[model samples]
Target chain A: MLITGIKSRPVYDRLAPMASGLRHLAIAQGSGGQPMLRLLADMTPAQRGVATVVYSSESFTGNSYEAELRAVDGIDLRLCASNVEALQVLDDLLSTAKMGTRLYLAGSEGFIGTAMQRATEYGLDRDEILREHAGSFVRRVWCAHCNAYTENVTQRIFRCPGCGLDLVVRDHYSSRLAAFQGVKADGEVPGELPEIEELDT
Target chain B: MTPTAEPTAFTTDETYTPEGAYTFRNSREGVRRLPFPFPDDEYMYSMNLEPHVPAGDGAMRAAFDIDEHYISECHHRAQMLEAMPGVHYLALPHMMEAQWDLLELIFESYARDYPEHFTLTKTGNEWHWQNRLLGIDDTFTFGDPTTLPLEPMEYATRQAQGEFVVLEERDNDLVIGAGMTTQRADYSLRFNLGMRFFEFHGPVPKLHEMGILDRALKFLLRMKPGHPVRRVNWSLTVNPRLETSVETLPEWAPDRATVDAENAGERVYLRIELQPLHRLPRSNAIVFPVRTYLVSLAELVEHAPDWAKRIHRALASLDPELVDYKGFHRYHAAAVAWLAQHDDGAPLATGYPWAEGGIQPGD
Candidate 1:
């Protein structure tokens, strides 16, 4: 069984024992980008042999995470730049899996929901996949006045809760794509396929 | 209250150790003695906060006030003792009870004088109030007076058993190393705070080699500074019966030939060392600030596989209240909610060591 979104320790502690019956484990995390890697680093020598893979969405370049990964004895790490890349990696891993494979999804509600949808599309058994979504990630806006990022789901407004900075969520996906395709921000942009990288394959 | 006039001709007892441990003496009847040996050593002392009492006061009131001040002074003495070298003070339950009484008096006085300035709640024998002056709740609890000695070794063991453990100890008065470990993936690297035990006297060499004594001393020194009344000297060593082991990564060596040639048994034993500092004073204070690393039983179970079942069983075997899922969840949630509401400038600390440099979601 593969578990994603494992941010809590209690959940990992509980799952680790039950995981003995399983062969392959894949941990997917969005924030901090290295939950599985951190777990593996702290694991005893006997525990590290359990074929485990970590898929992180956060950027790991030029960070201690790379050094941490090198320090860990036996674990595979896959860094996905965007949700599309993450889905591609998840699809490839699920495609070659047997019918009884279990996938555990953890993290923000939206991220888990997105993974569940992708898993279903990839023909993974619904019963085999467990979803443990704790909280929703409201759009966080950087407040200039308070010098803190604040998000309020109830208000549905982008204002700093700390210092009341009028903020707007900047859409990075389209802008980054435009820059990648050599299209000026003000120019008429050509429709292009969403860039997808198969990480596991 | 204009500093209630100091009673004239207040007969002060010179025997009252400035460390705040004291023996009560009635002027008319001579010294009132207890059955137990009075701890009059330099490490312990007693003081009388109220030097004089009106001659006509009722016996119950006099006893109650005396009890109150004795308890309060014990805390004061403990704080002072923390400043002395090689001396650490843990409060007994009676002392804590007295401190609570004093707090109650202070709260009552505040409510009576400035009713508009605070909110007060009386539930059974306990009174709850908020310091409107600071816009914060008066959440201090003198629930018990018995102060137990903080044991770091026991704490380390518990932490090794997957329980969250934070150790904030100073190193030779130069560096402060605060370690926080939680069962949470994100908080594994942060320093943790938990109940710990340390033997006062043991093989000093073993203790020094284990580094436990140094950590404990640093922890104590950070909590309490040396003062005139209190003096502390601490020496520690690990129990000889406790076997120690070590781990080394030869794979990360400079060359693969050297790494492959290296024997697996070439690991060095982790020798911890200890030393006694004369000026070190012992203190029992929660040095680590409470941050946002609380997890619910349900969340723990979901994230940590079988952690809920194991912790539930363990806590149930020790204290049944810990197994009450709803109660535990409520307590955990309340702590997180409290943290979210309070805007203390300290960053939200996590136990996950790997999340140190990453841009966290809530950041």
Candidate 2:
């Protein structure tokens, strides 16, 4: 099955269990920082074949023990001088992995997309692809002065609190589930689920 | 150049082939989903870790299934996002103090490569970035006072007109007061970085600025050593100025006219007063600011939906390039699932299924 969009959640959820099954498990974290390593240490056994990758940046250096693990596991954990360098290293390692092998891509959407393209070019089938988008959307309301969001009628009537523009609700669904949830025609709640406090708000 | 061949240092004695990739399958039923779980509720939340090989064992298992599964999932997510245009995923702890240096490097690369597309700013107390092409003016409120006085004092003394008159005198006690003000608003995206802590005075007596004096004297003759000194009674009073922003903030510049007009030319303000007590002692008082930030995207997303969508797409697109893609997925999923499982009936916004209602767990 060519898993993409929302279809990939099931696959992503099993990462920890799958890693446990490997004889020599390698975990790579791009150059965010030591938090990833601490999280990994808290989640996995030290005896597991665990390797980490860390890419250094101006604000951070991937010189910790966790970073070493990433390089040893055939992952590039150093800060790339340019986007091109980052794409190149990611492409090389992903392509070298054997076919039918499950590859886990974690990080920003841009990083995942680049790696996916490289993997496909290297002979991985579309069915082998799975993804989860991890970011919030930037919502722009209709400003009476700006006259934005006039295109979508369903979002009409509301005025921009910022600029008093005729506001229209814009959908910023990064994940397939979010997109699916955005499409409900009626006010009927999904599955009669109880309301949760808006923690993000 | 082909990679140089180097002897692989095996951390463990065990070795295994890369086959049986198909042996691991996604069991949908086995997976659990819940809404975002709060850190405060210890009963419903738990974290566990285990080693693949037993400690002190010479030859241990080469790999653990869970680790492989995490890697595979990360790869899958990357591919999925690649198919979707303008979406990105981000691994977090990006700017946590311990990880700030490394995350900053990654951010700089993105900024350099996509200068026109990305802009970084401080919102609330945190730092965040967004694609400038979206043309969304992220709004944030910052009317809190930056500095406040720890305490204020008042003193009174009485003098006699003639040398023979021994008039009794009393002293007024000291009083302390605190004030705070919300300053202004900026692009909300900056809040993602963190918050700055301001000085918050605790109890008034703790400030160490209260004291009294003892003196003794004879009316007709020169005073001798060890003469008894008359004790004067002392008392205190506190009056705090609540509306002090008018004097605190300087005259508005041409650029601030719009914001000042919007807020009725008034800044948000908060103040507290401490009444004086007789028994307190005199000591040096210290006032320091304690800073913190709130890095939430919800408010900005609500006000500027289109801009939020554009930034979301840009972030989604960048996911694969980031490390720990799998870890981010797990954390996000778990947060959503925990929210789903525990949501009580409350009003919430769209997109956040877990927060569709106002039922949030205690912190």
lDDT per model, in order? 0.30, 0.24
How far residue B211's Cα lies from its native spot in candidate 2, in Å, is 76
Compared with the true structure, what per-residue lDDT tens digits does model 1 show for residues A1-201? 001111111121212222422434454555323454544555566556654554555431222244555566665556565545766787777777664455655544334545665675666654465444332343223322233533222222233456443332222111101100011111111222123222110
Judging by TM-score against the true structure, name the best candidate.
1
Error of 2 at A182 (Å): 16
Compute fnat per model: 0.00, 0.00
**lDDT per residue, candidate 2, B47-141, as tens digits?**
11122221111111111111113323323323323533222211112112212222232233334533544455656545554534323333222
lDDT of 1 by residue, B9-110 (tens): 222332222233333222211111110111111111112111111222211111111211222223333333344312111222222322233234335534
On residues A9-98, what C-alpha lDDT tens digit does candidate 2 reach at each position?
112322332333222212222432333343344444542333323232212123334334453333334555543465666565665565
TM-score of each: 0.22, 0.20
Q: Candidate 2 docking category?
A: incorrect
